[model samples]
Target: MQEKIKAFMDEVRSRNGHEPEFLQAVQEVADTVIPYIADNEIYNGKNILLRMVEPERLISFRVAWVDDDGEIHVNRGYRIQMNSAIGPYKGGLRFHPTVNASILKFLAFEQVFKNSLTTLPMGGGKGGSDFDPKGKSDDEVMRFCHAFMAELFRHIGPFTDIPAGDIGVGAREIGFLFGMYKRIQNEFTGVLTGKGLSWGGSKIRPEATGYGTVYFAQDMLLTKNDDIDGKTVVISGSGNVAQYAAEKTLQLGGKVVTLSDSGGYIYDKKGIDEEKLAFVMDLKNNKRGRISEYVDQYPSAEYHKGKTPWEVPCDIALPCATQNELNGEDATTLIKNGCICVAEGANMPSTLDAVHTFQDAKILFAPGKASNAGGVATSGLEMSQNSLRISWTREEVDERLKGIMKDIHDSCIEHGIEADGYCNYVKGANIAGFVKVADAMLAQGVI
Candidate 1:
């Protein structure tokens, strides 16, 4: 069994060796799913994993635009149309200095399974550019988004490929990009998710990912006859996911102790209540300031420069930052500090070693594919509403989101129960997600 998995990984590395992020993602899936493939003859000798790894279409183009200084800038943009077996290509578009083929490919690949778990008619895809949205004015960002969409609009459509937001690409960026896409296509449709409420955006779209992540955590806790109520939770990343995760934790009667950004994290021993979270939302989303400013506003909280929130003792840890932000050492620290549950709010936030450590410790750890799927799931809901030409209320959308998360939780448990009676969520998520897509690919017959 180990040999089979090793050989599969070797082939994956040989082809995608240059793409560390993509390779890492493939390796994680391969380690769990390959063993299941060995047991299930339906998937054997089909090379389905190989087919899944290679994107059906990868589009890259040059994006040139003028900055606030009127200086010409050029950046590379890409869309990895990974798979559309079940539905249209669906994923998020990131705008950051680190956007590259490997990262987007990894994200797209993960999206494939994440979408499948949502039970929505959506496939996996991811698009992005290396253009940094930070420090750019409205007009400058608008021009960049227009330039980016000029090339992007050629490949995507409401029925073909739909993209939402991630990382640096927020509602504002999505609006600009959607505007450009609408102008070029000369029609208003559901080609994009995360629009403003007045312009066809779903209620709770911004909070879906964060809220869904916490909901998944709540489900995990329930398996142990536990819940988030009265639990001390430490969350990393102060972005959309982190802020709303904190919000949901508070609503569920949990103590949220931390929120972070690139600079470092801030520790609020008193717990981040709604008022404190609102301050953080303004600090990050409105003022665009670093997390260090948090201590200035909330004097009770201490800002930790150049450090993560892993050292804080808590019952749960939610990593909402970028990929590989949480490492094995951090995992050890969290475990030593008596942290029992870890839920990922970002795509592949935990490294392979960190994941191994968590799994080996026999703790309840939810991977990003299962834990942080709420955003895409709600995006799927948005697409449905767009097709129906009607919008659902906040409670309606949120209710459906919770139902989907519960279904995903049940699916994980159905596939991931160990002989010892513990649920191996990672294995369950990989295999369960794999079966759906693999069956679709099989019926399609080697496309």
Candidate 2:
């Protein structure tokens, strides 16, 4: 570790206590940025890294709502307005049972750089509640979302901070939150992304993360004279990200054999075709159902209990679940089964050990900050559309998204091409994201 990074880590430890996960996230970015800062003297000793590590503000509040049973429930809501030197705070609101200060902080910190790497005029922030949307009735979810937004709307705006969807927050949740924002503010604006198309939502917003992941993976494969066509893909998670990742993989002529949920994975030997994927979308998205439902619907598919999809043999793997879902053992299993590429569709889905395993095995691995940046990148686009008072067509938005993914891929190679002629995408993404914000911070001086 570089001295500046070591000092920053020490500072973090002193202030935030010894939280291992938070430290790991910060260290990952620092390791990449310190080298670049050393090479560029203007950035050295500027404390940009330190400033980037600490958020501009963190807002936590109590969310009170009524369940379907008419029982009052209380949950914690958080919004870390991380940075805004380059532009307004921009990120997602994840509503999962596992959310906490440390988790949101790590996510917000990572978002700062991820937004920068998109070359979009946006900063970093993350907000969410510990409320789980799964198994909740629509009315119950609406009440929770309305409660969450009642507190959050005050901190966000079209030009201030923008939040999108992540993990447990989706179109349904966004609609509920947006309704509350509009009802309270008495204005119709782009306060949130991932909204329904009827309410100024951009086309392809829901599919961006997964589509972007595959697009990033496609760019990576292109470097080695390959494409997604005819490739075997194994993707984890059956959420929006994983579903669209599977959709795009098939669109690109790739065969996806596996899709998983928290319960387990479903393996389809003949590949999860478009019809099967639609069934899955209906089951998970519409019905709020389980992975086992897919097995019951499709007799050919085999459902495995308490196991991830990585055990399947594949040329590509996309982990679209929550953080640290893929560990060292999973990485080893995928690599041993001839997995050549692993792209993250979820935030920090791969553990440190898993990342090292992929890197050591020379598998093309793209970190979430780069691979899943499509969602935020498109969020930035949505902001632009709102500002311009025009909505782009799905094809136009998708085309722009593809361009942004390619640009991110190019940016990574430009910054982090390693000695072995492989692009260290993680380093590239962090450095590229850092330099932009660092320059902006330097120009503005300390804040």
Candidate 3:
């Protein structure tokens, strides 16, 4: 079994040797899914994994736009239509300088499983550009988005492929992209999630991922007859996922003591309350300021330069930051600090070693595919609403999001239970997700 998995992975490495991020994502799934495939004859003897690794469609194009200074800037854009056997190509579009084939492929690979775990009819895909939105004027950003979407519009549609927001792409960016798509196609469709509510966006879509991450962690605690009512949480990243994760934690009576950006993390021993979190929202969303300014508004907080929040002792940890941000050492530190639960809000936020360490320690750990499916799940919901041409209320959307997270948690337990009764979330997530996509692939008969 080991030899087979290794042989398959060796081929993966040969094809994607230059793509460490994508290779890492593939290896994680291969580690868990191969064993399950070996045990299931239905999935065995099929090169499904091989086909899954290769995307169904990978589109690359050039995006050219004029800056505010009227200077022309060209950037590369891509959309990896990973798989659509289950449904349309559904995923987020990230705009960051680090956006490359490797990272997008990794994200798209992870999205296949993540979207599957959502219990929604959505396949996996991811697209983005190396165009950084930071420090760019609204006009500049709009121009870039327009240029990018001009190319992307040809490939996506409501029932074909749906793209949402990630990282630097937010509601503002979504509006621009959708406007371009609508303008180009001359049609109003739900070709994208995370649209403005005034148009067709779903309620609570912004908070779904973070809220669902915390909800999954809350479910993890429930198995031990514990709760998040008083647990301290350390979260990385202050982006949409981190901000809303903290919001949900506060609502659940959890003390969120830390939120970080790439610059560093801010430790607020006083806990970032709703009011403080609102300040953070304004600071990051409107002001576009660094997290260090958090200390200025609330003197009780201390900003740690060039550090992550993992060093802070907490009962729970949510790595909402980018991939590989939490390493083995960080995992060790969290476990040693008495952390019991770790839910990933970002795609593959923990390294392979960090994940192994958590698994070895028998701690409750939920991978992003399971823990952070809320974003895309809600995107799926938005699609439904758009198809129906009606919208659900906030309460309706929130309840659905909570239910989906609970379902994902239950599914993890169903597949991830070990001999000693410990649930390996990564293993459970990979297998449960693989079963759905693999069966669909099999049914389609090598298409």
Residue pairs in clash, model 3: none
Each model's lDDT: 0.94, 0.91, 0.94
lDDT at position 131, candidate 1: 92
Task: State residue 292's C-alpha deviation in candidate 1, in Å.
Answer: 0.5
Tell me the lDDT of model 1 at 80. 99
Candidate achieving higher lDDT, 2 or 3: 3
lDDT of 3 by residue, 1-447 (tens): 889889999999999999999999999999989988888999999989989999999999999999988999999999999999899999999999999999999999999999999989998999999999999999999999999998898899888899999999999999999999989999999999999999999999999999999999999999999999999999999989999999999999999999999999999998999999999999999999999999998987899999999999999999998999999999999999999999999999899999999999999999999999999999999999999999999999999999999999999999999999999999899999999999999999978
lDDT of 2 at 188: 94
Error of 2 at 168 (Å): 1.6
Candidate 2: segments with Cα more than 4 A from true spot: 1-4
How does model 3 score by TM-score? 0.99
Clashing pairs in 1: none
> Which has the higher TM-score value, candidate number 2 or candidate number 3?
3
Query: Can you write out model 2's per-residue Cα lDDT over 272-385, one digit (the tens) per residue?
Result: 999999999998888888988888888898999999988899999999988889999999999999999999999898998899899988889999999999999998888888
TM-score of each: 0.99, 0.97, 0.99
